[model samples]
Target: MSFVLGVISALTAPFLVVVGFIVWDNHWNGTAFALNMYNCTMTAIGFLIVSIVVRQFVLEPSTEEEIFTSQKIGGLMVSSTIGILIGDWVWLEGLRLLGSRKIIVVDSLKPFLAVFLGEVFLDERLERGAIIGLILTVLGVALVGLEKEDHNIETETTIECESVGAAGTEVFNEHTVLIEKDNNEQSSTVVVDSYAQQRKNRGKQSTKEFIYGLVMAILNVVLHTFGVLLTKKYGVGMTTFEINLIRFGFAGICMALLSFSLWSISNISSTTTSTTTTMTTMMTTMTMKPAWYLLPDASYSTWRRISFGVVFVSFLQPALTNYAMFQISLALLLTLESIGPLYSLPLSYILQGNRPTFRACIGAILAVIGIIVLSFKGITES
Candidate 1:
């Protein structure tokens, strides 16, 4: 069920994000900064809400001074924020442009990149097997990106009827119908040639987006690795829940401030033409209304759904994963995370009825193998 939630969160969170950006872009010309800030702020809100609810109902609450005063906690907060901000923004961007499946596969490169970073930054020596594993991992990701997108599978339904004629002769009639149910949705009939052409065009666009997503995924992996390292280094004394709370709280505050500043600047610049306009804009801005930050064109229902997705993806997934992290070694944590694609791919098939191409499956296997090799090496060295 957790794995299913992870898959659902991965797909749904980004979809809502892409939709929010699309609506914002169409209406108010949204910037990437705004989108990043929005995501961070909302994520922070989700964490805070959960924390408060848990503290009130399930656990005793601790003082902010106790959590924030320690030097180690402060270091963890800063380092984790750097990692979370960069990794999250890049990941969301990848999701927005490339889609969930492709982005998830691309993210499997993290362990490989982390190994390389370790060799460079920590002066760690990589075993020959680890080096070979790294090579295989890169090759697998390349193959995945290069594999052709699967075509829509159509299901044909046939019906036959027979009737006896007045002259005692048997009359037969037959009917055939073709229906394509994609992702559990029935699609309207489309001409084969035209559909093929459309798919080809879409494939080209998807290829371009995949390349872009690949780069972003790599950057995300690097930043996320750094963040994890920072947490491991400075997070020895604190509980995982406390560290996460501080991280989220600090990050949320920073993003909220940045977002408010940007919003103010943009509004001020736009409203400089007339005193009346300035006054009205100032009043609207001073109110610190959600409408100023959120998409004006988006409906209440859209906001509610997006908020729910953000809560699940941002809060619940991380809470579960972080709790698990406290119980395991970093290498084991990473090795487990590296299997995200394996879960995502199969779950997509079961839930959406979208089958992966053969090449994709092979690529996922190779990447998993590479991560396992790296994990084994780390375990032995430690």
Candidate 2:
């Protein structure tokens, strides 16, 4: 049951991220916010929600590693800030500026880039096959990125979307197609116009913001690469959970503090602490993070959705993943998990009811194959 739950968790994780981002954006749509402020606040809220849940429910202080020493905290803080906060900040910026599919083109470079960075910084050895795998993976993603752009079909029904920015430009090009079917004496026109508005809104961006977004994405790759190396160096043999909790726990508090000063929500009204806050042994840890000050006007329904969503994203998924590992080898679990990016295809189909291009699908398959090769190679060597 737990392993099934973990598989379900893995399958839903990507969908959850895309959906959750949309949900949060709707809640905070009114603000012309700084990118860092918005990113850090959301990061804090998500991390704090996870830390609080895990500490309260899953993790026992006595059973877990108490590896939160001063040096560890400091190093993890760097990872937290650089990897989590800053990486996500630039990522969102790129997402906003370039759109998901386009930014995904940049992100697809991560596997090879990480391998290269690891070799340089961590002195990790790489095989020739691994190098080939990395290159092939990038090439596959590049193929995927070259989605069909020309869809100038004229129909009786016209769909229009008020282009907000560059972000929506990246939607559904992978799945856009003209469908024609014939009955005995009539033809049916099936138009998937869900993102019709987005399709209409493509010609709405300056060249400068486009270039800037790409630069930010590349820089994000670098920051993330270094952050992982730093985490390994400074985290001192801590498990993934320990590393994440300490990093998130500490960074969440700091971001909460920053959020307190960034907005006037704290002084506008102070609701009493959450009823569940006192139920944890990590009371001292909880005090530093502001779980609700950022969303003063959130309705109960919104709060419930947001809280549960964060908990699922941060804790339940990882928790189930860890639980699944007990029943499988670590390498096997990782190799199984590495196919996550391929989920984007079926996910796009399920969520949007649109099929990706044949070329893009083949590219995705190749990329996943490359990842499998790399994964098995690492296991074979180690």
Candidate 3:
């Protein structure tokens, strides 16, 4: 059932994102207003569903890790998303001034960029093949993106899932376990501590969890790519925050009306949290990172500008992407995004489980190779 949901989500996600983007484009005229409205609306709907699910279903506190995850989901997450908007507004403004083509070209290096970020921020080692493959894939994806811009044909779609472990390490379930004794005969106690540290750094979630993480990661990449494309077409003048606000406004009205008419409405009004705020809170809580981490820092200007980046990353990105996929084609976008599996595979192994099987590794390698080939062939920007 979980796998089915994963597959369903993978299949539907890109279409939802593209459709959302298209609607957003129609409504907001490249301003943040459209994105905001869309975000708010979707968030309200999602929140209602989640509320119903939680209210109706099991609500057990499973373990210590789950407890930690829950704590992260609280107010800290919401504040962090607001921070992200502040930074994103600054970054988008820079991108606008810098121009779209350059921004996109820079954007093409996403996988490589992520790897670099991981190396710098988390001290993850960049493997020789991974680096080389990432470069090739980036080059290939760039070529494909360029081709897409020129020819404007739809892209293919695929889905890959990864699982995370408790210690934050990526574990690959597809591979056989390799047991190697330490050559540096350290004390057993120290060795145990080192192993524990390794796990913590890696983030070992469950297999199912790792897969979901991969899905979310792919969604992030796809949506950001679209954001770049949209920015190019509309120019940075479009306030994505406004788009989100409008989206949220409409979403709020709709959710309020619907909940009042059709569902059991909760008086979350006392919380004064909009659906966008709720989602921003939930997503940030899940990840345990500052929302501003996703955006660039611009000095405080208009309150809107200050909050723009955070709301976009935390709210608009998810909303537009969902709309895009909901109305448009999903296959191409998801297939392109599935290249995330390349990143997810190794990370899952290192974090969730041990290394992948020879076949799983080969599958991941081939996926990257295929992306490179596609890039060389060139894909449309749309």
Candidate 4:
């Protein structure tokens, strides 16, 4: 179950993120703070609702008041803010500065970073065979990531994606907030949300832009790796749902502040000259909410879709991943989880009927072999 769930998480989380951003782009025009505020809100509420169900009716509450002690709670809060909130913003920023391809490739390197740190910080060591397995996994994922050479990757007008994992650190990515054109009014607008709903229209990037993107991408990895390590340190004290409650609940509050700050800034300057200002203000004021529409349309059914990202990808996936890490090593778990495209490829073929390229097929096979070797080596080490 743990391994299966890990596989599911590695595949689904990134794509589901696209879901939450659908309403964001249409309504809020992809404000980073809005994404942050919205993601945190939905994330917290989703965990709260599920946690209540699990706690009240499914599982007994932990009598360990120490779980909620100031020290533990504080640690959890700090970790969550650093890992989820700031880290999330950073990766998306990287995406906007760079592009998804380079950012994703860089993100795929995070497991190795975590593994290296695991040894230095936690004295986590891997067997020789495990080391080889990690190399193979990273290579495979890279092959898959770099398989596409197309510069203009405008997907069919509608697409979906919600993901971040491989999680030696979460590969939180970015789409730089730019001034969005308001169709109702001709005035320029800027990105005011906390999330990157989509990659920017691709074009040649200057050296400085490339450098900035690379730095942000690497920084995003470092922060997320830190968060993952923190989880390994503090994750053992509570149930999965309990950990999630603390993690996302704290994130929601912090994200709200960040989002509100940007949101207020954007609105404060709106000139009363254009009727669109009033319309944008009214639209924002009314629509500033977590996507909760129950409609079945792929994009508009925001909450239903976000549930996949939140409940399965964030909540359950991490639990499974943590369990795998406990059984194996953090390095091994990172290697296995990092091959996200391996899992997503087959699902894409199955669901969308998009055939994989021969290149993709080979990459998937290589990653599978690496995963098997990693698992076997870890089991033997144990």
**For every model shown, what is its TM-score relative to the native structure?**
0.56, 0.61, 0.36, 0.71
Those runs of model 1 whose alpha carbons end farther than 4 Å from true positions after fitting are 1-39, 42-69, 87-109, 116-221, 275-297, 365-382
- List model 4 lDDT by residue over 215-285, tens digit each: 98898888888877776667666656667668777877776665566656655766534888778767875
Poorest stretch of ten by lDDT in candidate 4: 186-195
Expressed as tens digits, the lDDT of each residue in 343-371 for candidate 3 is: 43444345435344454455555555854
**Model 2 pairs whose backbones collide:** 161-197
The TM-score of candidate 1 is 0.56
Off by over 4 Å in 4: 1-32, 52-65, 148-203, 261-310, 322-325, 379-382
Alpha-carbon runs more than 4 Å astray in model 2:
1-66, 145-211, 265-293, 316-341, 380-382
Q: Report the C-alpha lDDT of model 1 over 1-382, residue by residue, as the tens digit.
A: 4434433333233233222322221122223344334445666666666667765787666545454446777777766566765666676555545543455466656656656655565444556676666666555655543442232213211111011111111110000001111222222233333344443544677567768877776677667777766676666545545556667667666767866787788867876678888788778866543443343334676566545544544455455556544443343344444443344455446644666678878987886676556544433243
For each of the candidates, the C-alpha root-mean-square deviation to the true structure, in angstroms, is: 14.2, 12.0, 22.8, 7.7
Alpha carbon lDDT of each predicted model: 0.49, 0.49, 0.35, 0.56
TM-score of 2: 0.61
Better of 2 and 4 by TM-score: 4
Top-TM-score candidate index: 4
lDDT of candidate model 3 versus the reference: 0.35
Prediction 4 global C-alpha lDDT: 0.56
